[model samples]
Target: MHFRHQTLSSALAMMASLACLSPLQAQTTGAQAPVISQSDAQHLTAAPSKLTLLTLLEAAWSRQPEAQSYTERLRAAESLRAASSAWTADSPAMLLQGKTDRPGSGAGSREVEVGVALPLWLPGQSQRATALSHAQILALQGSMKAQRLQLAGLVREGWWQTQRTQTELALAQTRVANAQQIALDVARRVKAGDLARADQHQAEGAVAQAESAVAEAQGAYEASLHALRGLTGLLDLSPDNLEATSEGDVSTPLPSADALASDAPSVDEHPLFAEAMAQQSMASAQADLAASSRRASPELTVLTTRSRGQTGDPYQQSITVGLRVPFGTGARADARQAEALAAAQEAQAMTLQMRARLQAQAASALARLRSAHTQWQATHRQAQLAQESKNFFDKSFRLGETDLPTRLRIEQEAVQAQKALSRARIDVSAAWSAWWQALGELPKP
Candidate 1:
């Protein structure tokens, strides 16, 4: 009874598995199954501890639509590579022509020819096929590299955006707190006849304005988190404290421009360029195949036949050497070959142009990084001075030595200084990202 119960349960599970494998769902790739909207999936996963830049990149690689596309392309290339190396069979053929004799009164007969052939070896066919397959493998690797770099850049940028929003939100909250304290003091002074009712009203207006700014900042912060979570597949992203001190030896001493340029590979080696080159190579191979189709190849043929005419001698056998010559497609083969050569030349030229463009972009990105680093140092010093000034003004205001307008002005200056500092950090981070992209190093493990 126990065994029977277990068997029944196994059957039920098998049925459930079959049901889950719906035709429509089965059609989609596993990688494509993660198509749930960012908002919907956000709740499904727990927030990770200390989510680093690499972790975010990995998540994007797993979930992004472009990743799926590259993966599918790689699979297709592999399948094609296998097909190119395998043997294939052609068609069966037969022929018959005869006339029947009626009771020995009259008789008529005619001869007929029939044959069957298969490819033995076509010149340049195997070499061209192997080269095309190798090219495709290299092309697919290049595409995968490109996709990884893109995902890394996106994740880093999203991380910075979220950080910046959090910084802004915190600053806004500080302003609101200060404004509230000032409002309370003015209201007390008005009740004690030390300040006018108009001053109290101005303080109240300032408080209201600060509150509105806080609300706006909070909204922006939340939006940034949502955007980040969409990319990283991490839902509960919250603002964390940023590093206050700069790490030592932040500068990267780069090699000479000539040296760097010399290290760069040719256009055919770059991912997109290589893919295009591979495609052109494949086209050329296909044209060669078409040309080969016009030539005849030797094949050993053997046939066994059952003749219906003679009752005693029904069995017959024959052996022959067979060949096939393409009758009409040779001219078309030349035309296709010419077309392929033109396409290959075009791809080569495009690759050269792309390499030039990529080099220029790399140079620009490096220059930008240097400029951003210098600017950030200056901005950091300015922020420090602004903070000191705000502190001085705050003390004076508390001692009744400074007016409300003067205090507000100092606070605004400090706020602007902090914002500039944040922007400078953001700029430096962006420059680093661009530099990585130019070097094709963003997706490196």
Candidate 2:
């Protein structure tokens, strides 16, 4: 699987390089006709190039709002972390006061005071706050990783869907070419008076059917391509772009099912699991901080006062220091602590659920990959036998030993068998992609 995956990566890179060339360059090099229709080429040309898996993943990531906001989120977490390290629990405030008794005795009496109020952190609260900030950073990083993995799954699905449709289109085109050839042969036989006119009509009808199938396949292929382009913001309509080799075609021996089962990584390592764990840690830290913060922060006040009695009296300055301890609001603290604890418990439960889901997905994907391998082998044999049978029937038909209906039936069977083989090959690649997705692995460059 690894070898085949690398082969596919190389193929995609090569195709992307080719796609980067101008039409004039392609024409000068005498490139073959594009696999896609002219309309598709026109539509795709408007999109950016570089359609490799990694490029596609990047393009998709760039479009995500969360990805765009990640830097700001990180900055905010860092700011909180810095704040937690400060000596003061909150910002300091300045206080000013002035008093006069001019309306009363008229014997000038005035007082002016200035003060600074500094908030203090409760014991253990600062450390808990720092822990929460650290957890916030970890949680954000984990969330980003999980988000990228989710996007990788989307890209994988779109990539394989496009491959499947392209395969169908290619097979449909081949069927049309074969049908046209058969029609020509039937016409020749009719002209020589060796075959009836009805045979020619039947052959032409087959050609029409094949053409219709090609048209349908083309539409489906274009739609899938468009959807992929939407995700990756890239389009390379080159024929070689569809030539990625499937795992079934690789000569590398696959690992045994038991080996696959044992190769599964621990669920704790998964991005979703990590994100849930981080969230739980953050919530726990928050609960701890809340528990320590039983009341509003205590404030230390330092004041300087100047007073004068009568206009000629000289001012006096004195410094006074005082401490203000807020009364504890047990109900508010209880509510906040309860909320944080509840959040922690919820996050823990989510972590367990995420682990279970990942394990199940990994197991299911592995089983499907194994099944796809088996199916590919059977389909490969079926296609080979169908081809041989088609060859025999073609010879017998030309020799006037086989009826037109029998020849047509053989052709249909051959085409179906070829289609199945192509689909099976694509399925193998798709299964591998899905397995990687289940394991939270992104496509490598």
Model 1 stretches astray by more than 4 angstroms: 1-39, 42-44, 65-76, 87-117, 240-302, 328-331, 443-445
Clashing pairs in 2: none
Error of 2 at 50 (Å): 5.9
Q: Give me the displacement of residue 13 in model 1, in angstroms.
A: 60
The all-Cα superposition gives candidate 1 an RMSD in Å to the true structure of 15.7
- Top of the candidates by lDDT: 2
What digit string (tens of lDDT, one per residue) describes model 1 on residues 205-317?
77678768867866776677777777776655543222221211135554356634676454344555555555556556655565555544434343333333433434343
What C-alpha lDDT values do all the predictions have? 0.62, 0.78
TM-scores of the candidates in the order shown: 0.74, 0.86
Top candidate, metric TM-score: 2
Name the runs in model 2 displaced over 4 angstroms: 1-50, 103-107, 235-250
TM-score of 2: 0.86
